[model samples]
Target: MTRREAGLTLVLMDRLRTQRLPRLQAMHARVTAGDCLDAHDLRYLCVSLEETQRMKSPSIDTREAIRAVLARLYHEITTQALSNEQARFRHAAH
Candidate 1:
């Protein structure tokens, strides 16, 4: 996706994370023994989700921080990645 699209997506993701993430966490917590997620896996998801939310902060400084983070993430994912993966990251979110 383009940077504009990615920025919009990041905004939407941040809005949803505060409301949806906790519910998702609760559901996994309530799952039975048959279902399990390792610490690393869960932590990765949490961190990723947190970044999404952080990117949409009302503060300008926070937005700049998120933009930097997004650029790094975009670069990391685009070093000969699939088309879809490339479409999923933004070089610098405006």
Candidate 2:
């Protein structure tokens, strides 16, 4: 799906779900929808998540901030984590 992201029309990657919507609005890049992840990307995700968590404002509840981060990660991970029936069906198809 096309979105007005970062002033560009992007087909967002499902692997990069973002809690920082404003940052996305400023720097989104068009990519495949529901894209799959690889090791390097996973490493980046972990590092970025850690870095962002560290930079989080102390005024806000840290738990809430972490939840938002995890929520975004969940959104991406779920894009690949198949449901029971879908898992079987995909395996069969493959």
lDDT of 1 at 20: 46
Candidate 2 versus the native: TM-score?
Answer: 0.38
Model 1 per-residue lDDT tens digits across residues 1-94: 5677668767666654575446444434433222334466457556665656544444568667756764554443333233333344443342
Best-performing candidate as measured by TM-score? 2
Clashing residue pairs for model 2: 6-25
Q: RMSD per prediction, one decimal?
A: 15.1, 12.0
All candidates: TM-score: 0.30, 0.38
Worst 10 residues of 2 by lDDT: 6-15
Report the number of clashing residue pairs per model.
1, 1
Candidate with top lDDT is 1
Write candidate 2's Cα lDDT for 1-94 as tens digits: 1234422312122223454444332222211233345565457556655544444332357546655865565454544533433665787899
lDDT of each: 0.50, 0.44
